[model samples]
Target: MAQRFGGKYSPSGQKPEKGTPSAGPMNTARVTPVGLRANLMFVPAGVLLLSSVFSGAGAMALGLIGAGVWTGGAVMLREGLKAEAAYNDRKVARRPALPRKILAAVLAAVGAALAALSAGSEPLLTPLYALAVGGLHLAAFGMDPLKNKGTEGLDAFQSSRVARIVDEAEAHLASMADAVKRARDRQVEARVEQFQATVRTMARTVEEDPRDLTAARKYLTVYLLGARDATVKFADIYARSQDAQARADYLALLDDLQSNFATKTETLLIEDRSDLGIEIDVLRERLEREGVHLDRNL
Candidate 1:
C-alpha cells in the first residue's frame, strides 16, 4: 500500500515513456462486504450441512433447510451492505426498494430457529435462539436507510432528472474502469483513475446545483459515452497487441478529456458564485429602497 511519490527534480520520479513498463502491478482492489463477520455467518451454515450427513432423514432435511437459509442470509447481508455504501456515497439517493438487510435478518432468525429445533433444543429455547440471532445480526449490520437522503426542499422532478443523468454517467465510468482492466497496464489504469476523478467532480457539481445539469448534460452523457466506447476499443486492441501507439493515443485522449471536464466544473462553480452575488445585490437594493441604510461592510 506504499504509494509512489515523485516530483520535478526527483531522478526516479520522472514520468515513464508511454511504451515503457510501469513499476507496479495492476491494482484490482474493490469494495466488498466479505470481512471476518460476514464470513463467520457461513460457519454455522457449514456446520449444519456437515452434521446433516450423519443424522436421520427428518433431521437431515431440517439441517439442510437451515443451512440453505443461513447461507442465503449471509449472501443477502453482503449485498445489503454494498447497497448501503453506495447510498451513503451519493448526495441524492432514494432508499433501497427491497430492504435487503432486514430480510437477511429475518432469514437468519428463521435459520437459527430451525437449527435449534433440529438439534432437539427445548421448545421454548428455539424462539429465544431465533430472537438472539436476529437481534445480533441487526446490531452488527444495521438496517437500510428508510428514507431518501439530500432531497429536501428541491423540485422533485429536477432532482429525479439529475439522479437519472448521474446514474448514466456513473455507468459510463464503471464501464471505462472495467475496460481498462483488460489492458492490464498500471499506468493506463492510473490515467483512467485521474480521468474518472475529474468526471466525478463534474458529476458532484451538477448534483449540488441541478441548474448546472442543463449546461453539463452533454459532458455527462454524450462525451462520456464516447469515452467509454473509445476505452473499450482501445482496451481490445492494446490488450491483444500491446500497441504502443494505441496506448499513447488513448492516454492522450484521457488527458484532453480530463482537462475539458475540469475546466467545465470550474466554470460551473464560478457561475454559481456569480449567481449568489447577484441574489445578494438584488436583496441589498430592495433593503435600500425600503429606507434601510446598511454599512458597506454589512
Candidate 2:
C-alpha cells in the first residue's frame, strides 16, 4: 500500500522548528463524523426507486413518491445528527429550534405507508407498516435534545450575551477554515487547525463562566476576525505564487496567535478561580452572621 508523504520538508508536513511555541495538539474533538450507519438510511429509498421499474402505472407513481420521501427523511436525519453532535460538544448550548429527528421519523412513517400501499397491502395493514417504520427510525436515531445545557443558575441576559458572542466567534473560525483551503498547502492547514484549537479553548473558558466573557470578548471577536481576514489574504497570494516568504510570515502569525489565545485562556481560568474564592468567602460571612459556627478548616 502506498503511504502518504509527510515530512519536515513537505508542504503539508507539521514539524515544529526550534524555538517555536507549540499549539498544544493539532487533533481536537469535533462533531461526530457522518458514518456508514447514517448513509444506510438511503438504502430503502434506493430499493424503492429500483422496484418502481417493474410496477404498474399507479404503483410506479406511488413508489416514486415513497422513494422521494425516504430520501428527504434520510437527509433530514443526517442533518439532525450533525446538529446534535455540535450541541453535545459545547459546554453551554440551547436546544435546537426544530426537532428534526422527530420530523424525520414522521416522514419515514409516511414513506413506509406509501410503499405498502403501492404493494397492494390492505388499508388496515398499511398503517401497521407505517408504525413499524417510524418506531424503528426513532429507536435507531433517537430524539432531539429536549433541554439546554450548562444554563442553570446563570443570569438569562448574561447567558444570552455569551451565546451570541460565541456564535460570532464560531463563525469567524469557520471563515478562517474556508479561506485557508484556497492555499492548498497541507502544512499551513495543520497550523491553522492548531490555532483554531487554541481559540476554542478560550471560547470554552468563557462558556464555563460567562463573567470571563467580558474580559475575553476582544480575543474572541476582534482578534479572531482579524485572523480570518489575514487568512483570506494569505491564501489568495500563496495560491497564485506559492511564495516562501508569504508562507513563513503566515506561519509566524499563527505562532503569535496561538500563544496569545493560550495566555488569555489561562488568565480567564485564574479569574474564575478568584471569583469562586470570593463567593465562598461571602457565603462564610453570611453563615457566621446567622450565628452558625464552623470549624477553622471548614
Q: Of the candidates shown, which would achieve the greatest TM-score relative to the real structure?
A: 2
Cα lDDT of candidate 1 equals: 0.88
lDDT of 1 by residue, 75-177 (tens): 9988888889878867878788899999999999999998988888898999999999999999998998999988788788898899889889989999999
Measured with C-alpha atoms, the lDDT of residue 23 in candidate 1 is 50
**Candidate 1 clash pair list:** none
- Residue 160 of model 2, lDDT score: 88
The global C-alpha lDDT for each of the candidates, from Candidate 1 onward, is 0.88, 0.87
The candidate 2 region of ten consecutive residues with least summed lDDT is 17-26
Model 1 TM = 0.85
Error of 1 at 24 (Å): 13
Positional deviation of 85 in candidate 1, in angstroms?
Answer: 1.8
Residue-pair clashes per prediction, in order, are 0, 1
